[model samples]
Target: MKSTTLSRALLASSIALALAGCNSSNSNDGGGHTLPLEECKTYQSAPEVIVLSDNENIERQTITIGATGDMHGRIFAYDYALDSVDVNAGFTKISTLLSEERAQNPNMIMIDLGDTLQGNSAELFNDLPVHPVVDTMNFMDYDLWVPGNHEFDFERSFLDKNIQAFEQAVISSNIVWDKNSDACATNGEEVPFLPSYQIFEIDGAKVAVVGLTPSWVTNWQASSPQNFRNLDFKNELESVRKAVEDATAKHQPDVVIGALHWGRKDGGTGVHKIATELADYFDVLFMGHEHAQFIERVEKDGDYTADQLNISVRDADGRPQNQVEDKNISERYHSANRHESVKVIEPGSWGWALAKAEIELYKDADGKWQIFDTTLANRTVADIEEDAALQQEMQEIHDASVIDANTQIGTVDGNFTFTGHVSKFGGDEAVHEDPQFDGATNRLYTTIHHAKVADMPLVDFINQTQIRVIEEKATDHNGNPVKVDVSAAALFGDSSNLTDGQVYLKKDSANLYMYDNMLVATEISGEQLQNFMEWSYSYFNTYQEGDITVSFNKDIRAYNYDLFDGQGFTYEVDIAQEPGNRVTITSIRGTEFDKDATYVIAVNDYRFSSTMVPNGWVSEEDELWNSADETVYAIRDMLTEYVAETGTLSAGEFTNQNWHIVQYGQTDAEGNLVGDKGALLKARETEEGSKLWQQLQNKEICVVREESRDSDITIAVNYKDGSTWYENPQPGTYQGCVH
Candidate 1:
């Protein structure tokens, strides 16, 4: 379907897209509106013609197909009883979405690509006779099942035993089993691989699904941290060969589907190339791996045009060659046609997204189901509806995924999730959303809360929202007019790796960085903390003691690699080279009253906090956001409520533009941005020592300085005169240099 059609469809739907809250055009309640693409009244989408202008009448034979990858075992723990009503209710929403779109067109087939196990709540109950996950999935009625690397994680035995888990045709053109054993031989089983193909007759259209799995499973066993077994994963091409030949030889499907268990982004190679080559064997390709890649990156033919990358890859065959990096899964399937590769969809890991394909099955076309038109997208969970039964199952799965031994040493009054606190949504939160709602406008009001625990019936005054500090009119708890910064810091666990709508329990030791500095205070101490914070100079480099005027999320690095460069958070009295590998607990300016006192900090939670870092890093305070509330979920409650009210979420889009962040390749130490027109991203390295180091800078007569004499610190200064002093520097930088 065209973007216009989707956008229009969005306008008609009463359910909200979490990330797209501000973009929703219809204010009134209209959850059921249906308008055709020709008469769409929503925001205009990019011209549909541009999407397929490269092809002629073939463009008419298009189907926008959306498929999701790496679902794992998410569907199973969805309902406790694992009943069809519950499973179908959960899937019904997706089905409803599919049905609505079908009204727009006719042949949209929603495909669940692969990886329907692992991290799934139901995986905990795999030993049960009734596999909740597989059964629910079967009820969902997916078009086909593509084998994932993890499917063989429990050893091939489980796969062999549960081959029937998938209600759809199980296609693993890449996996194999020992002959006549009725079980996937584990630990080097030499059986021939399974037939890699599945033929689908959707709306009377012939679509063949040829599946392939990454050979990387050979190196990584199932849940390596948990001692899951590793099996021999054969070449992706080997299985494709078997499946393709078999499928076409027996029956010529109008459309060939390549459901390879390979990834799209950062999979060492452009999986699209594999898709393209498979395209030579198959008509279309749906790929996985790399945690859901951008739809635009996977080309039907192969590698991007030279103009796009300024380079081209070719093989001995002299055409475009595929480059597989990291010595891993590469172009296993180079197309025989060399022109049509695959239509890949590297969907989000852990069931975060699902892709759907809408095609027209037309006649006068040999009366076969030839694809008439098509497109793909990583559908955001924000636009999704949670099946009530699925929700229950999800909870059970969560309970199962986590080991619930009598290890409950501490009981938090409420539960938590990273989505709420890591990504705040009030004043500053509202301002953050303005770019879409109006990026040019800044009407954000921040409310900061600080409880006076020392004083009973304690002062519950708002800090930024009316705390002991600045006051501003910001979004309230109801998402309406209220008070100051409502920043919440998740008390336990890192919020980075959390899947959509996951409810996490709060432990006493969890924390996040506030303004990117809390992690330093909590996670590191001495030199280690200093080193981490120094890298973060791009964000927390400067701060006046009492200023509360910046967005905390502005300079964060997601996935925990938001490398740090210590800046204003603290001045390191680095004495590493002198006597002791010591650094000082200078300050943590990313919070309310932070940096005022020396603290023992928790790395992640403190930095992500909007309320306060943590008692470990600051003066002790109640770390839990909704501690008094009678909810199992502390941080998780807010998000669940938000979703229940809004029914959608929005993960940021994938883009190559590094506007908020400097391209990693260009940034350098001492804060010099190589190609950014002298943008000193970090403090310039200088000879002038901080006031604390002046004496050392002035006394630099290369005295008989022994490494032991230094006071776990060195004073340094570059004097006005030629003389220079040195307490302890990083060595080799005598006169003066940046640390």
Candidate 2:
């Protein structure tokens, strides 16, 4: 039976519900109907039941599969130096490379693993009714497309509209809709949102391709409940297994391939394990989602008997093998009687490269096609020349986006720069000592200074916008405007020359968006707030007295470093301290912080959804408001409005320096300092030495570096009440953090 007919017959209810969710009145047009399963059917008959036809003739054939994913709307390459030079990997170059490959082999299949849309600033002005990326893909004649998690960032209607506009067959085995609501329900079973797989006839050979998505879509940081309300994600492996079984049963395909949208890194779910366990079922696996490039060949030796197995297995080359002997190896070998091997590859994101898998098949004695050999290659786009015709075709859209990005929003009297010398060891004076140290660490310090240390106009401006907007829309249960205690912002994207006294909504059309544009508000106890600050503090790596450079933890997302405004708090960071214990909130608005007190906080969506709660730095249950649902405008739009209305920007208006960082130390009850005060003093006297004494005198924090022959470094922090805490540096060769 045809896949569409069977799907319609089985999932009539699901189709109806999906159409309803799309808010379409006409179901006859098939606007939001699920894809039929038979389209990807593999075998001509069930593998267990099929009888081999002795007379069938099998011939040698070769096929090439080219794949790319997570392009993220990077249609044009970037020239970082000139900013608009268009000199690197992009769709135009990718198209040229794919075309060249196709010329070499007419039997090539082009597959996009997923995350093709979104990410570019141009997407903001993409009101042309036609998605440029989809148009480009159609021009390239893409064979199949899968939706990545980011595809669901927009509302369901938007997603449905885009899917309707695409010409390629979309496939995902796991996404399903409610089956009870449509007339086509077969036993009330849920049906796939898209075809589970597809079959291609390459030189008289049938090759089956199955699709899989990340099973944890609902929990995605960017996915809101409203965007994917009616959709359900099933176990990725189970979905693929079912699809493989169905395909093998009906088509008896000679080759089975998997085009999966799941990634193998950053704690991605199932795809890695699925590739390992199901190696025998698939000939090739195309994977994405981590935005990384990788290729690996996974092999499983057939189970061995006790006599055939040893403590370790070695190949003829005397090299150690990666084989493990299972206790039930004999059972598996007797039951399945086969070994498994599969090749997996992923192209890096943003069209940097394309993953190519070559499959060579030859006829076996039994007249069945058998894999002769397989090879994987990653073709990089760094040196590939852009396709001139395609570039010309997209040039107009690119120009328009550039113009939109250059639209002037406002002007400032002074430059907003991220450069300065700031470190935990010394205060702002560190910049005076080492100019190269300025960038992120200094900007971070400034952010904290403006947010909590003093009346920071920039952060305050952002806070006021969020607070005013939220107040206008939402109220407390008693109908009063909800009061917010803290507001946060991040220095997203590269710093621009706003110092020229003019500001555009974006730096240029090429660099158009700041990431901290989505706002979310939540309520948390003071303890949670402190914990959140501690999480921010985790960005800094601990350093000792002789450590010349104070660096940041590379593993932490740079954008997650947030500066909080609306609260007055001072913190002391001992680089030598552990993560959770590094930050000590000295006071709030000149008073001791009440740990049990509840405070409302306003933060960007990226910060709230992904960094804070998802990372376990904050609790999701404490969320009080999400700007995505509560407001009509994003934080960027709000900033635009605020700037346009105010007409002028001044650093003094936003500059608040209320908080200061102190190098942590310890002292005794009698207020006498301990440890290597001489080392600390000698280090401070050097040109590169952290001027700890000056910083302490300026900030009035009772911290002193003391000398001791027995200790490498000793720190003493005195309280205003005459009590002191003393500490000695832990012993270790300090290796800086990793990215």
Candidate 3:
């Protein structure tokens, strides 16, 4: 059969229902051949018998598993947001890889680890009878699907429809219906919303695959609990162990696999923990969600911690090379003390690579099939051919998304950039006569580098837009009109910017926002606000007395460095001080700062959940209003609407030089850059200083990597780009200079 849809009722009833104890009451690509859209089924057939043993008594078979995860809706090779061809990743390219694997190893199992539904233009067809991504995967004959955390980003109804619409099985062991929830009544009994594990028989050998999703969806989607209503995400390790045990006891499978939608180490719960703790339970574990690629092996008796065993095996030579040894060699290998081990593999996200694991099974003298050896590798699609059939099938939707991205929504008078930083030496509008600088480029410095030192108009625009929307649409918890007192936002997309005098399109909004975050408003005390500010400013490292350049804390993500701006407040971050004491409120609506004062603030839903809730600065109950209650819920859509209605976006409207950094040695006791070191910092505005600054910034001149005041400084001119020319330079002349 090509592909057939399974009955939703039958599938739900077939799922294991023994996890009642964990219940809680909370609160693909293109078709080479065009397949009919309505049919949902896997074209997986019986394993092609490829014997690996020469001994008549021993019969061996190799099963290859082809898997993809964290695809993020990259079906075509084109990026709708950028209006450019994206050769780096695409499901259409991945389909070519999958087709080859299936032809070479007919016994292959195709799987998607999750985060496949949202991210690109594919989201435009979410309301279709079947999601375009799902339809594509079904057409590709994907056997099993795991629901990822991003899958909960939409409404429950949408998720329900997609789950039922998939031709194959959707499995996740950790997510269960809360028995205590009124929205999901299961006769006072907890029920698995989907099957926990799937058993597939290949050549009379049973293989069971258990799926586990990230259990922190509660905190990640705290702003929109309705999306995951009546569900409680259980502990990852506990759920997987229980599911594995149940699958083993019930089916006595020869192989047990884990399809986890968590990362290897970053997430508190990941395959690292699984490899170290549950190594003996599973034969192999495939993972996703971190958008990483690797293959690893952890011995059951080894003393390896999660960190040591959690490495991603990229090079093929780095892995063990003992697959399908001769019978004589196999006997010798069997005689040695061999410890049982679990194999872990993950395909990088967005269809960049395909993770393939070839497992060798052999029937021993007792006529019982036992796993003998395995090989694992990740095939990147850099040079892979795109499946022409898939491109032909998805052309219409892809073209429509491109047209929508280019459709004019509004106009911009100037550029709004996150990456472009005006250079002080060259002047913001200075044009270079050099051929290399042919583009309409003017940059004195990189804002990302100086973002900690000054307020950015790019960030200001996001915050101002958020504040405006909240003040216009949001209400207090009691449904009373509430004014926004403070607003904060972060720069997520490094290269995103608005062009000067361009007709802004939907893609412009997407490029500027870059995330699906909804707007959120919350009430907080002035003390809480100060604490939040301090935490944000902590992105900067402590400035030592003689430090010439300010460095950032490598541990902190740039996205966590939020810039706060509002009509009611002004603050300064003193890098001269320690992190906890860096921020001081200079003024509050032109009044003395009051730590006890109450105020309303605007932020994205992700910021509310990932930061405010974790810091105890705000709670779900403190929510003044959320965009989830409004028709235009997404921040990107809100930005598009605001621009479209205004007809033009003026940079002056968003510019707010409210917050600034106070450097250490360059400042007076009162924190002004008026000292000798401060003069050196401001020298860029002068003739000589500007010339030297430009040359240094452009690498026309560079300093030796190993330099010190105690030693002769070797200045290498054109160090990076051209022939090296050296000069002996005065040490203190260029000290404290901002590049």
Per-model TM-score versus the true fold: 0.43, 0.70, 0.78
lDDT score, candidate 3, position 240: 89
State the lDDT of candidate 2 residue by residue for 707-731, as single tens digits. 1111111223212212222121321
Ranking by TM-score: 3, 2, 1
Candidate 3 TM-score over all chains jointly: 0.78
State the RMSD for candidate 2.
12.7
lDDT of 3 by residue, 557-620 (tens): 6678788989857777777688899888877776778899988889999889878998899888
Q: What Cα-based lDDT does every candidate model obtain?
A: 0.34, 0.55, 0.65
lDDT of 1 at 64: 46
Candidate 2 yields a Cα-based lDDT of: 0.55
Residue-level lDDT tens digits of model 1 in 470-571: 112222234553222222122111211222343322111111211111111122223333333333332221321211111121222222223211112322
Model 2: runs farther than 4 Å from truth?
1-58, 78-83, 125-128, 178-188, 221-223, 266-270, 298-341, 418-473, 494-502, 508-513, 551-555, 569-572, 610-622, 629-632, 658-739
Candidate 1's displacement at residue 543, Å, is: 20
Winner by lDDT between candidate 3 and candidate 1: 3
- Comparing candidate 1 with candidate 2, which one achieves the higher TM-score? 2
**Candidate achieving higher lDDT, 2 or 3:** 3
> lDDT score, residue 666, model 2?
30
